[model samples]
Target: MAEPTQNDAHLLIVDDDERIRTLLQQFLTRNGFWTTAARDAAHARKLLAGLDFDLIVLDVMMPGDDGITFTKELRTHLQTPILLLTAKGESSDRISGLEAGADDYLPKPFEPKELLLRINAILRRVPQNDEIIEKPKVLHLGDIHYDIDRGEMWEGDNLIRLTATEVALMRIFSASPGEPVSRSKLVEDLGRDRGQAQERAIDVQITRLRRKIEADPKQPRYLQTVRGSGYMLAPD
Candidate 1:
């Protein structure tokens, strides 16, 4: 197949190395593609919240979360193509990427052209995916159902209203169910100014959210507090 149109596709280049990230961004941009960079997996998640990219060029080893773990978590919610760059050429490492649903893997020390070629190959094979872009919006918090897209909750036929803040919070928590998200991280992602007051406010928001989704607000079920960490949303 002919190479995908670089002009038409946007790619996110994720790597912790400042030099490689800058070089790749420059090279990819010079090659006629739109590019964005993220320092690591956490930064990538922040970028992913606000933008859509045709492909993610991820480095295998990154701070906070390794690419394989990131890929597995990402696959749960997104079908976007991910091409992993591994410094090690071990079979086990390559197999891990594939097992985590990576579209393809390229060992490091490879030419930039090869990376571009693999990216094109994957994009060419990716299907028209508007319908499958985001994972299923309706998630079960025990018996209660929360629709991430509609920002609405339902108990039987009754509609439960969610404030804008609550809706936004649900969207964040539901995206990574079973993962503990830190309070400060939550504050930043929600676009709130960071401070003790804001952190306390997030606690308040969590309490209110629990009241609606938890079987018992005081003794919560779905939204359990992760001690020494933060809150985690574990849906059934």
Candidate 2:
């Protein structure tokens, strides 16, 4: 498959502020991306169910299911990259955004150019369909299986969905199945800024991923934590 370039990339812009949403849609559209605007999370969900988007620009403050909650819920089934916009500028707020599964956060009143740059950066981090050249290999985890070449997980004949971050982590761990990957290294590879908060975000993502890969997330048999090293994928 051909990789999507910025000129042809599709974007979903969700914001309660009509003026802001319209402006963003116009700005991004003029910049070559196909943009779709949604009034709120519910609208966004409806559009998402029927359309494929390269990335989502979501506003934090809304009437219902604010951005953080929406993002966390989306992570359960979607792997699309999400960039959050919020009025709050505190470091804690930024950390919360990341912890909620946002790929990047930009405070409100940010310059349009900066938003474009951040969006481009996040899109660049997405793995291209043709990038994987290794031989097809599958990792067995109890009844679950991860296909390295295809970047997919399966249980019996049914396919299991993985969020973007989880897919990235699986790729990293599959490269060295039994070796531990440091949280710092995972953060770096995940294209996130280095910080204690980012590391914690990785932990959060790992926990969510375990629920899918491990029979017992509380006592994981496949994804194990190393006391001093990091996390390891000890697949059978």
Candidate 3:
């Protein structure tokens, strides 16, 4: 394996189509990127286990463990930027992908040059250490504190346990303290397909999170309802 140049970003291409996978790997490699191709979710997992990647170019409609589900699961531990490939007319597909944590999307039958442009654009958006290192990222909700950089919740000296879904919610809410986050947006951010059931699920998660952070979950102080709006984190 050749040592990549400073600008050579290591990329993972997750697509079930053999031709697309090969073409992406070759094309990206030619464009000064280190590329690894995976035929499906399982193969992608195995590759991920052994190597760290800078970004992932994922296809939305795979046979088993589709892109939305896979992206939802991946965001739990990995924050590597993701760009999804979806078929045209998939407006809902694009929403769900973003909810599942994809950084960008490109409709299928897309030009290879366009994919390169989107990939570079997303990579550029990724925050470098120096860019964020100086800004204080600790978020306080009453006595509980969340370190956004570390994704760890702390209550004074002890650590608070959070499930994968809860962690996702925290990440979203903590990003915009005091700003209202609507329930519909919450459903998408949770990586679940849109429906009444998913919104209900978000409600349940919010209740549970309030229990952990709020002095009174029933009458929440830190996590407040905005009535016409949605939820807001008012950290003190």
Candidate 4:
């Protein structure tokens, strides 16, 4: 919007089609984003190892390793935001993409404008690290302390590792501590389009988060569900 700034956030574009890759590179460059093109997952992986990317635009229908499978594998270590491109528009396909840990998904044959909007939306949603803050914001839940500004969780002196989705959810909960955040709100906060499947997916992430923060996830104390309302994060 604001000329996208010369900050020139690095972007990785992974697709099998040569024409599409070239077109996307041109379009993104014109909008002030630095982009690299990869023909497939292997090429993308190689480039990923060499360069750091602010975001990744991946095609889900690659010949060898499909984007969904690759996304699941990437979730093991990388917390980089991924926007998936796919031709399939079925609900099941969309759910699969989200379940695989994609930050967002855009169906193929999409307008360049839409792609631009989605990219900006995701960039805006990235968590802010508190390393530079003079006074960091921390939420205390029992023995676990959540560093809001850094998107991190700690147990006394020890730090915990969280998946990308978990970090996103924590960011949302931290933003409005002690308030009830609806399932739909969590879906939107996680960069997911609203729907039953996305809501269900949020439930799964919440369960995982509870396991990390609660002494007994089945009987969550800090993360409690408000019947018919949604989930609330109660900190001490």
Candidate 5:
């Protein structure tokens, strides 16, 4: 795929290291992005208060306000894309970054090319979010109301928590309401890449989602599986 011209997309890089910040600003600018640099989260916040950015590249480790806490607080009001840079080989740290609302995570010492690819992939995913938010309105299944905008399913006044996988599946199905989404397509959409095992896992999630939203689990109304096509959500 040809890289989209990022001439209009502004990226904010937040890191305490002056050398890294300068290098990335130059490299990303050469690659077609408009770039801005900040010394840390505090500086990034100041810049953000004054200007809007297409995305933010934040380093996980910092002296005062770390990336995780900053991301968590920022996500309260902002849905902008965030990519976390952390120490290499820290899978737990990467997971924490995602939990704190980061769109993606790249360990330190990564190739600049790899970062560019990740940024493109995340930008593609961002559009999918916009499309979902613009449609479905909100699915009313029995007593539950699923907000496609927030990836949140609420029952009456209570908020029902969903695992990451479940949320991903819901977004995919919600996007094509009244249409059957094949299991293979769901696997690809979820970014699971787990062969058949992940497909089965999706089945488990469907069962759980049905129990929460259906009047009878055995005979689901909202979340239903097509004989061989996969799952279709017929939301009312």
Candidate 6:
């Protein structure tokens, strides 16, 4: 499979503020990404049902089903990368958004160039098809199988969906299957700023990922905690 070029990447921008949404759409389109705008969560959902996007730009505050809630819902199936926009700049607020499964968060009043950089950074973290030069390796976890080269998880013939962050985590774990990856290291490798909040967010993402990989997430067998070391992927 060939990787999509920057010009071929599609982005969805969801904001209640029409002016802001329009401006962002125009700005991103001008910068080479295919941009689509939604007035709110409902509209965004409708668009999502019909169109596939490489990334989503979602605003935190909205009339109904706020960004955090919507992000959680989206993670149930969609793996598209999400970059949240929020008026609140507090670390707690940012952590909450991440806990809800957002790929990244950008505080409001941010420069357009900064947003572009953040978007690019997040997209770059995603595994590209061309990056797979080695022979494909499949990790067995009970009935589940993870393809390292394709960055896909499968339970028999049914493919399980993984969020962009989950895909990134899988690549890191598969690189060193038996070794522990420190939470701090996971945060840094994910291209996030180093902080306790980001580490906690990584923990949340790990938990979410376990739900997909483990038959019983409460007692994870493959993706295991390594006491003070961090987490390890013990494939069968």
The predictions' CA RMSDs to the true structure, in order, are 15.0, 3.7, 7.4, 3.2, 6.4, 3.5
- How does each model score on TM-score? 0.53, 0.82, 0.62, 0.81, 0.66, 0.87
* Model 3 alpha-carbon drift over 4 Å, by segment: 1-6, 132-137, 143-234
Candidate 5, 3-44: lDDT as tens digits: 674435789999999999999999888888899999998888
Q: Of the candidates shown, which would achieve the greatest TM-score relative to the real structure?
A: 6
Between prediction 3 and prediction 6, the one with superior TM-score is 6
Candidate achieving higher TM-score, 1 or 4: 4
Question: Candidate 6 lDDT (Cα, whole model)?
Answer: 0.88
Residue 113 local lDDT, model 4 = 85
The per-prediction tally of clashing pairs is 0, 0, 0, 0, 0, 0
Give residue 84's error in model 2 in angstroms: 2.9
What are the per-residue Cα lDDT tens digits for candidate 6 across 4-61? 3454689999999989998998888778889899999999999999999999999998
lDDT of each: 0.78, 0.84, 0.79, 0.82, 0.78, 0.88
Candidate 3 lDDT tens digits, 190-217: 5444776557557766776787788888
Kindly report which residue stretches of model 1 are placed more than 4 angstroms away from their true locations once superposed. 1-7, 128-236
Top-scoring candidate (lDDT):
6
Clashing pairs in 4: none
lDDT of 4 by residue, 91-175 (tens): 5655677767777778878989879878877776665543364567889999999987677899999887675567777777776
- Tens digit per residue, CA lDDT, model 2, 139-217: 9999998998888899999989775667778989999999999999998887666888668778877887898898889
User: Total backbone clashes of model 1?
Assistant: 0
Worst 10 contiguous positions by lDDT, candidate 3 = 125-134
Superior candidate under TM-score, 1 versus 5: 5
Q: How big is the positional error of residue 110 in model 6, measured in Å on the Cα after superposition? A: 2.7
Model 5 residue pairs with clashes: none
